[model samples]
Target chain A: MTLSPIQILVIIAAVALGTMITRFLPFFLFPDNKKRPTFVIYLGKVLPYAVIGLLVVYCLREISFSSPAGWLPEGIAILCIAILHFWRENVLLSIGVGTAVYMLLVQYVF
Target chain B: MQSDNLHSPKKPADKRIKTKALKAAFPHTIPVLTGFAFLGIAYGLLMNSKGYGVGWTLLMSLFVFAGSAQYVAITFLTSVFNPLHALLMTLIINARHLFYGIAMLDRFKNTGRLKPYLIFALCDETFSVLCAKEPPAGVEKRWFMFFVALLNHTYWVAGSVTGALLGSTLSFNTKGLDFVLTALFVVIFIDQWKQQKNHAPALIGLLCSTLALVVFGADYFVIPAMIALLAGLALYRKRAEKGETL
Candidate 1:
């Protein structure tokens, strides 16, 4: 490592501080004492669904579209998950089967 | 005298509730258990390869508690020292957390002493689990959320520590196992879609993120995606407000 121990600790502290700032800032901005603006409340209602979508995309962000094979495993697995989830509406079942399918694809099929 | 008597009975009952909440929360965290363990182990192994020991791995996983940021931190540790740059990178990577906090503002309200920890521990998986899984009837919501966060945190810390100590001893082709997290999010997205009357938000999120990804590439897409997401939602809110008023 190029960094000395103290420098490493300083970087870690800085990272930790930055992380806490992102996580904690919203609560501080819209404290319970003050009236949260309507836009903020609207965001509170809608952002969760949107954020989950964002997360799903974030997970697949590494997949390359230039090659068909690059995206195949994730594409197939997500298809299976959506199908199984809608068919059965079982959370664990869908996630378990989907992940197992993806593991099999990437490990063997792909 | 009356208040003291009331508090006395509630204390034991509170303990019972906490235990029950922990039990209820465990099943919901099973996916995260698999995901965090694999990812954390990968993280720990990376740290070990970089010559950092168990202490550094454990400390980063426990204190920073953000997976992507920690991975970025490893790069920082190996590169020329620049604390300001590290902090900026961390902030950019974790900026999505701001949205999680906004969404959780109400659900986490009235959590009392547990509020700070709940907010502190609101990592991506914890946030998703808490957002999707409401406490079962008669289970205290605050306690359930707390246990969910605590269990995920434990899995991550333990996994990293195990990896740090084990250091590539086990032999398993664990490739693609980390898809559990992706699967978890997709399932939750579906659940939210079904539960909510409006689909615009979910659609907006997917559209904006995908657009940004195409435009910005993976490394830089997140912030642009976040900005586009906020703009899309704001426009959505405006239209919905008009529809409601009319």
Candidate 2:
């Protein structure tokens, strides 16, 4: 709100442009018509696993170290999710139950 | 080989295949639907609280489409305007999309006209679903992936619009609904962990990100963590090349 409307629009446009660049760059660099390099292909196979791990950590980046509750809510919920997922091998059940547990913890227990 | 014969049967067959793909894709996207609904609504509510109207929320959710970056944009909008910083931040936050694209390059090939929109709509949740789920037998892979991406995008836009319009109206205790995203990533991580023989990358990702988070704090950790991840992977590649088990 401090800036003018045009400035806001410009900032939004900048963000959109940046995002599009990240999404489109890989395709542009390694077009379908050309065979990708071995390293690029290797990275493709392993990167998804690493990226998913990074994403999980990214989600927890905001956990407060100084809080009384600390990491209990997130820790418990994730533990339950892992157990439920391994046991049931069900994606929706694991996510749904885990989220429900976390919600309850933050809403009441924490 | 009549012109009408070629056209007439193909339309219904195409329709049936698309329908089959959509059906296969929906179940995979349900988790994304829940996560996006909560997160997008929260995003819209945040924008509303910052005095932006529904139009801005809709525009952002439609155009920007990246969740964390848009949240950061809220900060940029309120502060002294710096377009360069906003752009840089968005790039850093969304740099992971580059990896998603790399992983999807082959699968997304031969998708014809659907490729552009599929690439455009590949957000984190969409990427996760697309990477994890494959089309069932008789389901076209391109349409399945397309619907997953499209449906997730729709959920996000719809959620933001609903939140903007319902600003401060709902009384439900939705305090921790945003944890759905975290749960989603954790589930996907577990699935990948179970399927892959190499645990090094996963461990490296967690350790590097956690280390970077501790050293740099939450706001500035992601880029450094990504750099560390690349370094770790480089070492991993070397060891594997030497025939070492990891």
Candidate 3:
């Protein structure tokens, strides 16, 4: 709200453009008919592992020691996810159950 | 490669095939439906809290469509107008998609006209679904990917609009709902972990990102962690090629 409507639009436009560039540039670099460089192929193969790892940490990054709740809810919920997933090997079940546990802890217990 | 491709069905993406693909793809996207709904609603409420109306939330969700970046943009929208800074922040935050697009180059190669939108809509959840799951027999690959993207996109937009309209009028507490994303990512990580013989990549990712989060703090750890992970992977790969195991 601090910025005028036009300014907000401009920021949004820039963000959209920047995101497109990130998503599209790699494809342009490794177009069909040409062999993708070995390193890019290596990245393609392994990056998913690393990317998901980063995202998992990204979720827990907000919890601070100064707060009393700290990492308890996140830790417990992660345990719930691992258990549910191992027990049933179901994505929805694990996420639903883990989030429910975390929600209940935050909303009621913590 | 050409002979193998020529043997596969070269369906022209007729409506019937596309519809069939949609049917097959919807079930796979159901998990993403739950994840995106809560996350998108959080984003919409964040925008509303900043005094931006439902119109702006819808416009940004429709246009920007970058989940993490949109959340970050809430901060940007309230800050001073510096287009250059906003652009840089967006690029850094979304640089992860470079990996997704690279990984998808081959899958998306012959998708033809649908390629651009597929790339545009190549979000993290969509990437996981398309990259990790294959369509049923006889469903066109392109159409399957299309529906996954379209369905996820629609769910996101719908969730944001609902949240915007509901603006501060919630009858119930919605705190901790964003954990859906965390759980989803953890689930995907476990799937990848179970499937791979090499756990180095996953371990390195977990270690480096956590290290970055601790060292750099949450507000600015992503890009550094990414850079560190890339360097770490390169070193790890070289060691692996040198007859080193584990």
Candidate 4:
């Protein structure tokens, strides 16, 4: 809390401004009048799928086999999520059930 | 007669169309409500734990809107003052939004006024939700997307404000609650995996990110993972565009 209220606000505003730059920069670069390159278009098409995969891995970065919880909760939870998604084909059910399993394991078993 | 019928019944009033779009958009955002509410509350509690008040948390959620980056910003808030350093960190943390924007360029085209708001509010959850699901047939895409974006934003703000109000005064064991975010991404990944005909891009993302995480370690893995994913996709496009794998 060394920063004053105004300073904290500036920090918040700066983060907001910085994030918007990333969001809007592409639109600015590839305006309607100009043609986006084929490479850019291709990346756009395939990037979403890959990014989500990265996110899944990203979310579990803290895990290590050496840890007491080890990877049991995450491993079982992720497998459960995958299986539930494939079985039920329901996003909400998969996530809801998977998270519940993880919370249970961590709070109770782990 | 067929051609005439095509255009006639579809021309609903703008208000009616908008109401329909909002309805369609809302059901899709229910998962985001649960996810963002948890994450946002954690964020607010963290800020409250650090002595920042409810006002700051609300404003941060309102303007910044980016979830992970906002959490990182809290770390910067307590430290020594350096706007340049904070800005750079914010950009790096949010650089993923650049990829989200690129992926969304086509879908967002012709969205008019909603386009700017869409871009402004393109958090990971919003992007993932919109990217994975399209508006139901007959719903206006622009309004549908607008409502999706608006609803997610609202959930974040509300969750944070509530958490900030309660976090300082209340104490509870909320550990392991953050599993919600991981579950969310896992669900989205599964849905996207099912929706797509090809799985190479998804596998590429998973493998490269896993490698990067091992090699560069987690703290510095994201940018390199993105670069590797970009390169892998670029190489795949060569084969993909040639009709080897559609």
Compared to the true structure, candidate 2 yields what TM-score? 0.87
> Residue-pair clashes per candidate, as listed?
0, 0, 0, 0
Displacement of residue B2 (Cα, Å) in model 2 is 18
Local distance difference test scores for all models: 0.87, 0.85, 0.86, 0.86
Report the error of model 3 at residue B245, Å. Answer: 10
Q: How well is candidate 3 docked (DockQ)?
A: 0.70
List DockQ, one per candidate, in order: 0.66, 0.65, 0.70, 0.67
Deviation in Å, model 3, residue B210 alpha carbon: 2.0
- lDDT string for model 4 (B3-114, tens) is 5322244666766887898999999899899888778887888888889889899999999998878878988899998777788888877887888999999989977656
After superposition, candidate 1 runs with Cα above 4 Å error: A87-110, B1-10, B171-180, B244-246
Give the TM-score of each candidate: 0.86, 0.87, 0.88, 0.90
Task: Point to the candidate with the largest TM-score.
Answer: 4
User: Model 1 residue B152 lDDT?
Assistant: 96
Per-residue lDDT over B98-181 for candidate 2, one digit per residue giving the tens place of the 0 to 100 score: 889998999899887789999999898898788778898878788899999889999999998888777767546666766877
Off by over 4 Å in 4: A68-70, A89-93, A103-110, B1-12, B243-245
Best by DockQ: 3
Rank candidates by TM-score, best first. 4, 3, 2, 1
Which pairs of residues collide in candidate 1? none
lDDT tens readout by residue for model 1, B1-246: 345332354688757887899999999998788778767887787787788889989889999998878877999999888899999999998999999999999999878778999999999989988887898898988889999999999999999898778775655565776687688789888888888887888999999999999999988999999999999999987887788831
**Model 3, stretches more than 4 Å misplaced?**
A66-68, A107-110, B1-13, B244-246
Point out the higher-scoring one by TM-score: 3 or 4: 4
